[model samples]
Target: MEIIPSNGEIFLGKEQSFICKSSVEATMKWLSGDDDEEIEDELGRYKKELIDETTLTLQVTASKVEPDRIIKCQAETESGETTNTEIKIRIIQKPTFVKDVSVTKVFNADSDAKLPCAVEGIPTPQVTWFRNDMPVPLLPGHLSATRDGTLTISKIQLSDAGMYYCQAYIRERNEIEHKNVTVTVNAAPMVTFEEPFPKITSKSNASFTCSVTGHPKPEIVWKKGEEVVSDDGQKYILSSNGLQLSITDLAKDDEGNYTCYASNSLGQQSTTLTLEVIDAPRGVGAGVVAGIILLIILGTLLAVDLTCYRTRRRGFLMFLSTSILGRPAPRVKLEDDLKKGTSDKSHVVNISGIDA
Candidate 1:
């Protein structure tokens, strides 16, 4: 006896048929596995047919068949000799996922995360990970996958949060299965500034603005030195959703290191900046007073020259000399003294004889 197409394989829940042909007329029967248990047609579990005196057909359901089972064809010839041919059945079970598996995972920044795909099959399937429809690269210390369909990512960041796809592939069977997983990563507060430290003048208000970013909206706190700053309406004020802290009526005491602290459920962060309070300017300086006095003196000298030109018809210097010396000597007397006085030139136009 010989079994046609000796190798037998079938997918789960499907039916497979086998034909056994004998060289001579004989009584044919089917037996299962090593025990040689006779296969019967009872309850329709298996179907058996005889098309001719030498050919026998047997049908079996894969779901009812055991792994690596052998179906043997036995032919008893009229000469009382038995001939046997057998085929081994290989059953293939498609990969299927277990029930009640979690598809979403949440983690904080800088933390480790894992996603598990619970699947089972006759032949183990290969598990791979993909992020945003692209394959996830497996790094030694960063991202990795396990044979049991679990993906792990180390030191996760905000950028790592997204949709992840887990696929179970059986290459030989040309079968594929996938599941979507959502990874959520939350971060702590991060503080930034446009102007790190500011210089403010005394007697003017000082404003320190803080820029912060985080998940779940972090809480903000302002501190001066070791003391917490609060809104007192007149002295301290907080606005712009508590991102800005303003100190009214600034003074020298306000100059120091001020801290802006931000915190969330994930973590906390802070930044410190110095507040420089310079003294406000005082009244007019000495240089300004000196310039004013110099301008006044120049105006007085110009006024005296104008007055002398209009009233005495003489220059300011000449008028000043006449006022210091007494009435001037007459021009005619001065000329006569030069022509007549030869004995005493000092007697020329004596001040005592000059006309008043």
Candidate 2:
């Protein structure tokens, strides 16, 4: 005959077997826990249980064990009294991690910044960073990382300034967690000239300097109208002094206007200046008094010319007639000629007959 038990062993979770003859009473025993010695109630729970691995043959149970009455097991079996066999069992549980972790210090942009973070969880969770929901590049020289999990950014830029988040990953149980930090770089660079707009020019070379400054540093551009002026080997040159635009000769064309632009990852900022090329009066040797005197003389001459023209225009017709005719040789001779000549020709007009 063949006999089989679910596990070939007796245990509370696994099915066991019974083997006995003609329904007689019997008993069995089984080892429980890792203990080599009989398990005591103070140290363990659930007494050793024994079950027939073959056919249901033994009936066995005990209210107490030899070492400690407190250690207990319940078993029921039916068969004739026979020898008992003890069974063996084992006990253990899995590992775990902690929570509520965070970064120790905050960071800045364009400037070097770094910070370490704390992490805890089962299986040592994985970590990473994100800016505006996009994975930020943690490249060396620009960015780097530490073994304990720290993110560092070098030569930080305005664009680098924003809300940043850290992500932790745990594959087992498939868990993901996140933490966030916000950063601000600095304001836009300011552009200023050593001399204000409409700059005065001396015989010496003229210089227009843009004063540029900002965090993460900004790129500067100098422009004359739509055209870009070239300096250095390239059309553009950069410095903390802002974009320097130097022209050896100060021509009248250079006198119009110039512009300076400041740009960075954060955004863009700008300002403009209108340049006036005023020639420093030829020589101071003549003195300021001479210039003032010259201006006065020119003004007086202009006033005289205007007055003469106005007078002539006002009486023009009368003056012209008097010059051409010579005004009738003094009245007396005219009266004598009129009296002698008119008597013979009858100087009376027809209207004299109609009225006195």
Candidate 3:
């Protein structure tokens, strides 16, 4: 008798079979190593099948097989003599994770970070590391791996933050296992303004915006000089998220250097905003003042003309009244002078006539 396969190797959770062939017809039985008693056939796990009168097959299911176990097939003839052959079985198991990787890990900027992945399997599985789905090259100072499948990073930076994967591979089983971890690097607050403070006229609206980035989500504050700014609702309004500062009815006082401060647990940073406030153009202001002065001059001229006309009227009326009341005495004196000598004697008679 002879066994079809002399030796066999199979991975765990798989099936293997050994066949025995004899030249003459015989009763076939399956047995275990060095046992006088015949091996009983189990329904699905272990079974003995007769291919023909000269051939017999022994099938071992995945659950029934063990590493380094021997399976024997025996053929007994009608005369009660038995011939047997044996085959050795080797089992391989795929790698499996002992502990799951952490979903996320945080590290401060310029600090060190460690990531671990533990696995268990036969023949010692090999572990590899990857970042953002790309293979990580071995760098002496920056990145390295420990003997226990742990990845270490020195002087972590913002660029080093991303998805990291640990893969355990077993060549014998032709299987691979993966675990994912996300690394986050916390950095100091970085502040930036979209635009410089703009030039605005009085009673106009204006806004200042600042963009900030940090690991812990830094807080933003607006300040002018030494005083902190608050939302006044009517004139000064802060945005819902407090990233922008809005001003309505801008005035000359608002024109100055403004500061935007961003702070977090890591550190703080600030930026300056230069605001310029300009008045109306010189030509327009000069024109308005000149027009007011011209109107005042014209009004003064008109008042002077009305006063002179009233004065002239009053003087003419006084002269007319004096002429009418005192004219007869002067004419009478001139006529009397011419006839003074002759009228001396007649004066007495004329006085009497005048009385009459």
Candidate 4:
């Protein structure tokens, strides 16, 4: 075949073989017409190289051929040529790399984000972070990259929340593998009073509670009417159970709204609990009550006796008309009685002998 060039490109003919560097010296002898044997005749007239031949088989990537990588032969033909002639190979840049990565789940908004990075040509690709399109600052505290190519956001607040991206770079290929992540910080919990406020006297024990809810457990702080009630230094007690706030031992001045502040790492929430204080009533002793009962009984008896006396003075009595010992009668002398009965009257002259 003659030399031919089309569109600034030279094409290798079927008859001419570009042997590899390993068999360069031996193949040069044949190209320079030093051999006139079976090898020469087999390559020219027979054209047996293209009959049952496959492309080259490389262990590494097609475009990543390096100095020490081995090129495998499919037929294992030990022709002693030390290289292949029919095999054709070329070197080119790697294809476009990792396009994107994502984190589907996160425990909390302020927590870190998980991102996966994948490249087209190779592993161990260099990773970089960006916001919108500009490169982000990689520092100790503000931003950090993980071993698995994930990004951990520390103290991610609402301001630091938004779309973020990661890029995988392979310098030789001019390839870029990119990923996008969305960050949302979970809001803090809120606390509130759900029922009637506690009412009590200085002499009585009083208790009240408030409920709180949010992503992270919120801390509660209570306050009296105008003064703040804290655990720092006071007689007022405040206790919380993540969801509840209880205050005990109410005082006289503990009236009005008792404010409660629920705070978390994300934000703060507040609520007011109206309180009413009452003064305890004074009680009477047992002895005083017993004397008052006695007086009441005596007054009832006097009224009953006066009513009975008035009824008896109405002259409601029965008079008997028979000759009884209670009748009024005149008395006769013993001499008049003796004159009526004369026979015995003369014999009774003596006082001892007189009979009536």
Q: Which has the greatest lDDT?
A: 1
Q: Which one wins on TM-score?
A: 3
lDDT of 3 by residue, 177-256 (tens): 89889999999988888777677777778888998878788888889877898999987899987889998888788888
TM-score of candidate 3 to 2 decimals: 0.56
TM-score of 4: 0.34
Better of 2 and 3 by TM-score: 3
Q: Least accurate stretch of 10 residues (summed lDDT) in model 4?
A: 1-10
Query: Each model's C-alpha lDDT?
Result: 0.79, 0.51, 0.76, 0.48
lDDT of 2 by residue, 224-267 (tens): 78776666633334444546666655656666668888887666
Residue-by-residue lDDT tens digits, candidate 4, 154-267:
666545666777777767546676767765556686676766566667656555677766655677766665666765423454553633334445566656887777888878
Per-candidate RMSD, Å = 12.8, 19.0, 19.7, 22.6
Question: In candidate 1, how many Å is residue 323 off?
Answer: 34
State the displacement of the C-alpha of residue 224, model 2, in Å, after optimal TM-score superposition: 16
Query: Estimated TM-score per prediction?
Result: 0.52, 0.34, 0.56, 0.34
Question: 2 or 3: which has the higher lDDT?
Answer: 3
Residue pairs with backbone overlap in model 4: 98-177
User: Any idea what lDDT model 2 has?
Assistant: 0.51
> In model 3, which regions exceed 4 Å deviation?
1-88, 122-126, 130-132, 136-140, 146-148, 171-174, 194-205, 279-356
